[model samples]
Target: MRIKDAGDMTSKAQETTAAVSRQRHRGQPYVGQPMERLEDAAILTGRGRYGDDLGVKPGTLHAAIVRSPHAHAELGRIDATAALDAPGVHAVLTGADLVAWSRPFVVAVKAPMEQWALAMDRVRYVGEPVAVVVAESRALAEDALDLVRVTYRVLPPVVSIESALDEDAAILHPGVGANVVSDRRFRYGEPEAAFAAAPHRVTLTAHYPRNTCTPIECGVVIAEFLPGDEGYDVTSNFMGPFSLHAVMAMALKVPANRLRHKAPRDSGGSFGVKQAVFPYAVLMCLASRKAGAPVKWVEDRLEHLSAATSATARLSTLEAAVNAEGRILALSYDQIEDCGGYLRAPEPATFYRMHGCLTGAYDIPNLLVRNRVVMTNKTPTGLVRGFGGPQVYFALERLVQRIATQLGLDPLDVYRRNFVAADAFPYRAAAGALLDSGNYQLALTRALEDGGYDELKRRRDAARAEGRLYGIGFAAIVEPSVSNMGYITTAMPAEARKKAGPKNGAIASATVSVDLLGGVVVTIASTPAGQGHMTVCAQVVADVLGVNPADVVVNVEFDTHKDAWSVAAGNYSSRFAGAVAGTVHLAALRVRDKLARIAASQFGCTPAEVEFADGRIARHGAPEFALPFARVASNAPHWSPQQLPAGEEPGLRETVFWSPPNLEAPDENDRINTSAAYGFAFDMCGVEIDRATGRVRIDRYVT
Candidate 1:
């Protein structure tokens, strides 16, 4: 489980590749080099600090939220008098109290539903928090919650996307008129003509089920209101898009400066699950303010499972317009995603994330996609790993297989015909994502060869001859990264987007500072969910600065107060490799440039003529003409200011931000890159379904 070096993993992968007759040559070290992770030992040895491990002040009260048992209900009355009299119970808070103390949570998407930390007026989901109990201990808080009775007039629930979309369905949010929250269509190229002129047309439909990552540690929050500064100091186990500072501040009716969020040094895991923890953060802050003391709440398994956000479930229909030879000319998609009870901040993000990859690995020149968001009586859905890609590819790839079946063509052959040419990149997808680089055909061919595709087919035919059932399925997907922050604004109308002003790009920030002793420290905005972020940071910085990976330190904890962050910051959206790594490299390069200049002065050479290698600066191709990197780094912080390079800053420090090139604002067409780089995964899964026991055994998966 401990990743020693970048090569450590490469060696194992090479062994596997060699077993499959795919051995390749090794390359340079550092960024692509192997190195052991520094964070693993502390984590594996039980020294990590997770959410529940942190506690508030001595007299801090504990809280337990009372959630709605009914999916749809009208609020009648809440009786908390008995709970206030319970043992050790300090106070019981209801929607009425929150109404006086706070505003509804902010919704980033242009949906009509108004959401609050605690449900008020009516409950739309089964686990909506209706009230809260605060006490000296968690046990007392639980007891107090039971004593506080809430009366509800239960109403019919809109439980499914189909039911919610019914013409006669009850509107989940009263003013929205229908369960539909947002609906729009986007088209690229001549889709109508392409479908009309095509000799072949294929369609596929499927429902991607809703799921959530059950992180080992559930949501926990501790908030202390500093009345002296009129600000709040909150510590929680949450991977934040520090931009939430403004969102939570707005909900609390305080200025953004009054709120600060910090994460523990270690988190169990968040593959997008922690995105939903913000609402609870504001709730705990309210509890603290109401009780006039710090407050803490640790969610139990039941609460976590029933209330936490999930990956949005989607129902999709995909169509392809193809030539007589099976080359796709156009693609179309009509999809309805269940947003659950509320369109929380960034709810509709799942729908638009794959806008650029709608055509998948194809070079379809014409495309159209119609997306609709629906609200149902379930937990709200937000970000998850592979958030939108899985659902989109499920439908798109299934269509690819169906096309092959109908046309009597090999699936791989059909895919090969449609793939974007290797040299065609940076090719623009029909939608608008300017794909940076890829060799789709090369990748697919290698995968087929390595997975023994031909051999598998032979085995399948032999099995069928013996009256055994076997099948293999193929799916091609484009995984997008470096989430464009401006893409979310597409949910708003053109006028609204314009009123919002010039759009910001998808950006990530990193700070690199060199110590007088020549050590490097990198602080990034991203928090790790055991993803070896520290290891990657070390590798990238060490490679850029000409130092050992072990010598470069990475600050893994994401504290909004300490990190150089942006609105696009967070661990979601598959952004690290494209955005974070690039930012870290840029920052490190700045530091390295300064070091080179200082070393050049000492070595009596021009900066451009000097090279940094083995932690020393020397004339290019001359190892003897060198200055130790440490001696040069010391000049910035320890040397007399007069001796510093002219026009150079005083410290060997740099902070840089990165945004993808060729990024454009969403036009009236609602088209955008959505992500900077597109990483493709071609998967072939072999499985056996045992009809007797109805069990599925996955025999092999090649990606």
Candidate 2:
């Protein structure tokens, strides 16, 4: 909960390699400072341009996608003749049309139920888009959708995990022969011995249902194409290159490069469902191209729930192997990943990503993750707040408590015993993910101490004596990020996936420029759906440059053509606070070097001799012999060698693209990224369950 003097590296070397730090006071004005958002002025003054805010309006028409009500079905004739002739209705198209134009492109993806931009022959999931209708107005688009009717030979939808694998079950796809849509099995360590030899082993099965992102703005995209030199320029809130791009490009039948996805300065929020909106933009752009007008489709509440992706509904079984000392030994798991219908998004990436981090922060030495990405009649499951971390964490963390109870050890003791030692650098998860960095046991100890675990348990036991039912739950999770990946809805062959790319994810680009007036502006590629990238990015610059936070400006909008950015992998995983800060900081350092060079030329001193503080540059001592940063900028430009020092460039600024290395091979035994930074938090959740009715209520929760 707090960090203090993380290993005590003094002023001579301020970087502390402390395993766990509570130095809230020390890492300030940068990492732990209480700073306001840089975009606050514009956002508060109603100048922030969200998805629907930035656009060109010129008889912009609306479009609606007609979806199949059945989970699996044989398609018949799609009668859009009436809808096409209806007043204000422009056109209607289907999966066949998309396929005919070579519009639907399914990249090398999870095989079983390969994705389709539009349902081609059979519908695999509920709300699978089968056709589209474009109309003159938003109201007209809704009314016109009812006119396009497609009859179906509906089969009973595959609904449950137990029923999905039966040989006699209705085949969702005759070509695939099964509801399974994953790649292959990936195994690492030995599991049978741990399963049989452990002093205590227990397996628990639990079902976690689908949960959607609660983004304030539902998915909306308005697209237009340019036929001349500029190409297709789509301006909307659709961002990221997930399976949606492959699906929409195929559905729209356009080159990926031709479809330029321009997200607004602000997206409402991104829990990951927004990735699906990109393909929709491509489809809308194709429709706009066909109709010779801008096509806009603003998803209403029902459409969002019925159409967009949600976190996968899963039926998971967790097994725990505990030693005599409460240390975890070996574990086995069988999870039914309900990856919905398609394999576009982070289908394989999600499962594989977590498959490696599934064991949380514990030191479990052996694990087997058996996954079956099943097809269900629901919206496709995509990334939520913690991605796949929460489900497995809830299942395993809860089971650890019960395992502790069965073994007659403190639940927290079991947790502490199983944690990777503070010195266990580059630890590995049994499944296959590689952990980069962490001081696990230290973080665990700090959390237990900070939460006052002993004191709280004493109070809880006394409360029980008073006939009050109170129990505390502790959940520990390690989430993987900066991964170059796609969704592994289930375990699959590494070679089959096309998107779980960059073996070690990437960085963002930022541009810092000093105006003639001396004020600073930094343009970053990371757009905030609300994780506060802009505010924090500027802090990295201000801290590095020794300037007031106000004097430093951070912008989220940057030209992909001019600005150096590598199509930043989405802003989920709470990655901004750590990764983004470091990225923009590197950019600031580049600019700082330039500023130092300019100062050295002007003040008859080397860059190292000139230390900038409080936005002013002075040659070490002689504080009075200084110049405001603005004055240096005001005098730099135009033919003026006589007015300035000889042999100096024009401006005092710079920009650079940042990319961090990702070379740690994960321990496939416990799903740990033996390489990334790790921190700890204390969690307490109180649940009141009715003995007679089984009604559950979370009385209180804090993390």
Candidate 3:
């Protein structure tokens, strides 16, 4: 690996299966077709269910959050009597009201920052929810909220990244000095010497702006109360069952198992933005409790932009230590992240939980990473797609390319020298995470060919000579999915994590049912807003069971009952389809064993003698010995009583709550809590930078 940088991402570059391997389907047509989404038909026909689409209950109320207009301010009196009398006004609720009836909901995160579901006394940021109005309709909610008045005394605001980090910066929190929320520093090797001895080094300040996962169907949830009971049920377009359930349990002050979260189809798309949903969902649910009806909270475009979390806006100070060979000797970078209002949004874990992903795909020896989450008045930053990996990769790879150009080596050659070689399967990364397994060279080679990197370089040089400002950039990122949430617990203050809830039990679950009528249904607890869980699962199931993918059906709806899961890192890192496919295939294998036994009993042959042939069972040279599956299934119970395999049971079925041990950690197979397994990393984006304007445009991007 070139310059030893721990946890630094670099690019000069560029599913499923279970019981069935690729070697089994060389000549099959159904093996590789891109799957048509199961819900698209219903969605296109306007028949699919969404959170808001779930008909609101009678006397159901709608809400409009009256957000703080100032960034920081003194607590003041709120006048809502006028709002109470407004058209269709049902109720106007405040943070004080919540504090009086119910204590502030403070979900612990790894960060030291404190949070109340709503501001308890002072305002923190613009658009921070302070008071809420519940009314007859959404329009009425807005109208009634207008009549609610709050008087505040403004304080100096910390709004920029640099200002937030200053020693004398206004403390966002009274006791916590300055605006800094979290500060972490780590080192693996002697980076100073490496940088000094290196024949060449490159230092640059790079900035990655704020962007977020904007799912088409914005986040919307309608929480309904089962009449005459304190129990509440949630229906909406949400991300995963795990984290959402945990967050809700914390907010509602109920047992984790009591909150019933139901999702319908894909949630437009959440990426990392949906992690913020749970806190607010709890707020909406509590609002429903006051109104004595279901309450609907829908995020509009403006609301999403101003209120939803964004990626950590980072100003990275990057320095690379490189030999003439372009071998990385050490890498060190200091980064300042704009965490916005509170680090506790996702909590202490949100800022540094992705420390592993920030390291790209390279084998570096000594690495150093430093980051300080600075609290600003801007919207608090949370996870976005690629999470923090994209930011680190962009800075690292771009810097590496600059060093290669100075050393007169091909960027590709420089990149290859630092890559975790193909022979290095299950390589232990410099930053301490072990890669599951992958052929980096193969993927890079494929991407190079497919991307025309060689040809493009020549064209780029020519284009530059012709005064066309063309620049090509590449970043290879190594992202570990199923990031052990427990890591979040360990990194934070001991009490913070212990209070944050249980160590992540990263497990995912699926329920598969094959009725005698030839319908195959797979129920998954992880909801994929866009990633093709259905296609991937069908592909795996078809191969393992010798059935066409079209014959298999996947039911991905929003409900806590159909599928049970514990870890809720909502679908991002492109893990939804892959994780579900592997797990469901394992379940299918368990069911297939049951099928084989049923077949063995009916055909009067051992389970091993039966082989799946064209979706049916057949013995060598005995075509008449082949028994129809439905026929075999029908005779299993009846024949068992007559003669059969004596004690064997009939009707094939098996259910497994596969909670692999490494369920809370990286998908380290032997580890006790590993859940979703992701094994590869690749990212390339072409950028056009204007030095004069200090602006950059992504001309092309591939992930």
Candidate 4:
């Protein structure tokens, strides 16, 4: 029934899937084919292992944090005596105690601020940790939290972006002097000149509400500090890039190699929520080191929602310059982003991720953007699906609609007029984003057809004539994948960047190996958040090796100590479909190429003469002149080494790294290709409003 309902509304998706099925049936398996998820049985049947499911030694301790009730407050005193006397309680740790043992967390983007495992001298936001209580069980830990007494001197809270940016607002970070942490302006072409020449202009302002990626399971971490030469081992349900291991090590004041970070095979969900779990990873590591035993901390629902990060709230003003025909000539945006409390490692990414996508799907030749990152008494912002794309498009698309309404023109016609043409392959946007490939018009046309746009418009007009409120809106959005890390460098000034040198690009790595039985094994750095990464990986490998998907084993473990990882490796930025898949394909190809060479040597033909067919290595027009993959695979590792081809290693294993070539450092102007591939999504929403209650009901939504 669920599938039927989904298919009823998703006709275009079904058509794409059918096309892929036809391609797979023609013997081009995988890549485009839709394969069944390999993890469903293990996950649904209760066989999956999550972070909280990890068991430690019998002496392991559980920790609970005492958090601040006030949004902004000075730390006066913390009385842990009563908590220490609680039954089963082992130790009580305060922020000052942890401060003496650990250094401040490392910042990815340079902002004048300090972030630590616990709030040291003051609490900037509600639910900020002040003390931690460790006990024998989770229940005892929770019970002891109530006994910990904390005194605070409340201060005025800057709750909103406008208030945070006010002249009289109190500084959140004294070192920064103001609530604004980072501010910058980026412009391309002659925006002022183009605006002057345009005969029509429209301005729009929007306030995007703050929201969060609330996963079913909250943050959980288990940390153990081994004695003597052995270091710390921390396990979590963290879907990560694992580059955070260095940051955590810096906070712990230990060698980066000493902190071994491991993630469970499965996490309930991330949608970018679990990236913020690293600070808790460090906090629990501190708890375990102080307690002299493994320690576990699992965040409850209230704590997760109140304290965990959120997508930054934005206040934006967009101005669009258009010709008489509704073709946009110039665009400008002024935005203020509310980044709560401290600027976490990647908090402000939600503002800069779409630097290239600021113009949406338009061919506007002139553009300007100014972003002010303001600190407020709210949970720090972090990664979420769509990142900053939706925010920019919301303002721009709304402005486009207003222009049509004000000019008495069709909104759809206005979008078609401004769209970047299909022939503009690798089109460079005004903001310097290289749109690798997309057909915006085709996507829009398909959406209109799929959603019955004409019929919907008629119904909406008829409803409006009857004194009922009904409206439809359209948006053309460019979805980018594989973010270039260099985009963040733009947050700093050009003078600062000149001193720091160049920065750019994202990289993904994968390792592929063939066992003695000819079974394929693949390992990548990505941690899956229920995305079926393992299934897709196996299908790609099986396609390349001419074998069944069942014969391919894709290891989805994200262990910094073992996997082939780089700082740029992760599941964020929609990278799996572009960079990660390409990396895996490259690694698998290297192994397949070697296997072909070995088979060619046995067949007494050159490497180019060998071809893959029906799970066997064969020569052209010779069905019987083929060698079983098992026979070829065993020759290298298990058989004699002298039998191998010249300059070929006697193993069927290879590791490869892939990075997009288009990424380049920002020039004199703060502009660069922020991503690799640019895909377009056309969305139309029909909404009806109740005038009395100010309630909005979505009549229909098509994407």
Candidate 5:
């Protein structure tokens, strides 16, 4: 019955999907094809230019950071005299120097907790930077680190959610007065009434441990303080959420325009860990100022693991209101996030990032959320793979399975009963997420058949009969991408947010130009950390211009001073496909339209009658009469400005700044569409537990 209702609801959406499919197949030949990445040849052959590959400058010096060994402690005198007297030592930077030279990094929450690039009078985490040594070489700097005498007075540390919340727990930030920094409660759709009237309720409490992405390359920064008022020039492999660039500039006490920041063409990989490098970038900038030379700091493996950012450790308690038919009607969430020792700039974001999709793929209409951000004696938290989705879904899916058990129904049946109806898209979720499009029921049905669900169940039953522990599982999720910049502002109270001004949209920029020699060049601010932005950009631009993908030149390097970018630019939140590529396509279209107009005028036809294909522009119905694409492109600049169309610029260049129209600021009730697009994924897996070894082995998996 549920499947039939879903099929009935999907008729209109299926028609729309078919129309879109046909439209995509019309002129986008290069886009959907499996073209190899153009960046691989250089990267795979070891010719890639990562952060460290920038090479040493004439007066380059290396830096070694000294970190606190105690989880929580009061700082005492740091005696760097011996380190300064050591061979090849240039200078030593202590917390006092940083306090005098820079300001604490700006954080999102309203709490007055101060976090500087280096620890000030107190250290709250084990790996917090206490001092930095600059020397002639990296090894010398490292050697000098041990020579610097430091004193510390150990303090009680809050290491867990319970400890952090305890009345007697030592406060990490005295100004905040408590370990919990941000807390908010949101109610949507009368969840109280739904839960009270429901026939059954299921609850789950789960913990997601702190974790980090281990990229092949860690943090690296090279900074040079220009003489006098010229300000700072810094290069780093910091794959931004470029909002931090402004934060860094503020901390460095320089105007945004004065700080010139650049990322190398290739980053080893970031996932999301590299955003934390902004703090270190500012640290090295100040180091360069003290050392009176260009300073380079390459984070060693130990430093990277010990001090670098990690995903927030989340504690989620979820309750589901269900009907006798196994349909979930409402949900209540009490979520506590451990953001480590400091409330990093984007700390509370991990809680709100997935707020819109809190209920996951279900069609639950009522939701109540109690979100809290707590601090503990651990590494600070920032973006990581799946940012907040994994933690949210972990508890949500578990609650669904528990609902099935309580109702004595099959888990799969319970899932199908609650999936958002296909025809109801663009469905607005309870928390204000606009689920754009999907056929959830059909997707799950197909996944089950393709994954051989019945066969797996039979195998599992047989193994259980033989006293072996085996199980089959399935999960469905609504994956959001192209994050709206305004969603972070939701962390603030609605009244306070009004004073802060309205924030929304994920802005991206791209530039398409035809060189004087008639070669196409594409420049984008989407910093690709090995995600193949170059390949996709080329494929997109080439399709729009009707040229071979190989002929299109795509540049993915980012420069704050040169590239047209916004605070929302840079990799994270899966923005490349929707925001970055969208801008590239728009810019390419502008260039393509210009060339088509030029060809139209030469052919004595309307611009609408012009067509581009095979590197040539011709009349739509008359392919025989065409001009080479290069000739049409070059005519505007090289030979024929007088013959150009009226009001047409005499250059083949177009720049586009794009953001999806659907993104909007949070409403008065704090409901927001946190992302521009919501994608869906369904996975089924078969696992067997090794009775003796206590390990689980995946026998089969399908997605």
Candidate 6:
């Protein structure tokens, strides 16, 4: 479906405002209040169940992977005779086993690259898994790993973006014919005309390095190949974009329903790093099948750093068309993203995640984007903190600073001049992002006043007079969250996407139910690493049901077979607040409405005339006529079905799936809202540089 026009959006916004007003009048006491996380007590007390803690089944075998030290090489022969005969060795698996038991994972782009858990004919990167040794214990598996021998013929490696782009660079995927996997160009407005007519222009190139967050608990997986058609039961600390569950099932050569994937109660942390653990989960399932027992693997720190995924290293060149007043008229971007070794799924995304907000907080009306995804002999890239924000904004904001210097204006003034007007939202960006609501100018003014901008400038000037290097910097950004699932499709061209059918929306699922004892229960599909999801869920349910937050029980453990989850579920994109929590609130509202109906029947009043407050239900105007919440809730299903409202269901359970209405697939011109909501952030910081030691210290900072 197409997105609504500006007029329709304005009307919808008015309706939403009215609903929020009614909700405020109804009172929500617990929602915005801060409370200690419910998971913290269990975690601090060592009672939390992590991935390694869940593989306690008897006869569970430990697995250690043998990796290739060479970055690029042709696979020759794998002789596992010695390792297979080693003490406690159950089985040894090579590339041959992977070929016989599994299929290659599906790629997101229209590239013919085949990625398997184990290296087959050729290894593309260092630390690529070559073999797996399963044994009674981890030590034995490690010992056996040393005895497995494999022969390789080394080839010249394409390790850098510059090297990969060279005309004669070694082809990593012969089937695709080049190192560049996905390349596309897009134009939103008349950038050529704007550039020719501009009074001033500034261009700059910047590089964002590849990096990864190290979680305290590394990747861990327990896989058991159930006998016959029972399929696979795999548990991991693989916080997802659970969309990969189908990919894992395909690689295992089984139907999606046959794969029972689950996450443990607690993962040390993900920060978007754990999504890459799906390949290993599939690998362990094959190891279990071969060894005739359950197989478990825990990644060590070295393995985690070397083989685990990192954010894409991006090289961006930005050019801006500006007038004399430092107001940007248009922008052009030429970006090359390094997705090391393979074009892993959900990638090339680093180039497009910020596509909608490419202009940052500016009011530029024209834009041109040239995006390229290059493959190199390094660890494959995936998600990390801020996804693509740092890479995009680094170049965009730096160009703004350069523009300020070129115009002989203050950087802050340039920002103020280009800022989208406060009343101009719900704004439509040059590239198809429908910015819902933001007051960029107001936010920037507040930040400058609160950060003591004048005082910072005086301090910098005083330090510079003493032969010291001190400077103050400012930036305004649009933080996009609750990502639409279909935004990734923008990587494909408009025609390709059309052939594949329209994909849109960022759907989240939640369930609210009342227990037999009248306790409130909330279940969410999101897997929390450190975020206080349980506490937030409790607060939402409590406020909806008019009960104490402590009385609500929240369950976050996710099981593919049992939970009411969509492919859009799981914890990334900062979706907890806008998507997941919104769904939880929706589900609670459903239950509240059902309870209100039951209460109104007993109070002999209309459902809208019933009031829910302080663990009791009463007629709105008659406080003397009321019933305890537990009594009314318990009697509905257990003691008195006859007292229930006509046509009302007996149980107090509700499941809800929610997606923002504005999320639409990329249009004919490839314009789309990549996220459900847009939040504004203005940052100002003062830094001092040590001339002799080259150390930089932050003296003041505000966001």
**In candidate 1, what are the lDDT values of residues 196-295, reduced to their tens digit?**
9989999888899999889888888988777876778788777766667778888988787688888877788888888888998898888888888888
Instruction: Give the TM-score of each candidate.
Output: 0.92, 0.86, 0.85, 0.94, 0.95, 0.95
Relative to the unseen true structure, what is the C-alpha lDDT of residue 238 in candidate 6, on a scale of 0 to 100? 85
Clashes of 5: 0
What is the C-alpha lDDT profile of model 6 across 315-361, one tens digit per residue? 89999999999989899999999999977777867777788889888
Q: Model 4 over residues 110-197: C-alpha lDDT tens digits?
A: 7678988899878899998888899999999999999998889989999998899889997889888999888889889999999999
User: What lDDT score belongs to each candidate, Candidate 1 first?
Assistant: 0.81, 0.65, 0.67, 0.83, 0.88, 0.87
Off by over 4 Å in 1: 1-28, 609-611, 615-628
Candidate 5 global lDDT:
0.88
Report the number of clashing residue pairs per model.
Answer: 8, 50, 35, 0, 0, 0
lDDT string for model 5 (308-346, tens) is 989988899999888999998899999999999988887
Better of 1 and 3 by lDDT: 1
What lDDT is obtained when candidate 3 is compared to the true structure? Answer: 0.67
Better candidate by lDDT, 2 or 3: 3
Distance from true location, Cα of 507 in model 1, Å: 1.0
How would you encode candidate 3's per-residue C-alpha lDDT over 215-312 as one tens digit per residue? 77777878765555446788766664356476566666766656787776756778768766766777787787778778888878888877878887
Model 6 Cα shift for residue 137 (angstroms) = 1.1
Highest lDDT against the true fold, candidate: 5
RMSD versus native structure for model 1: 5.2
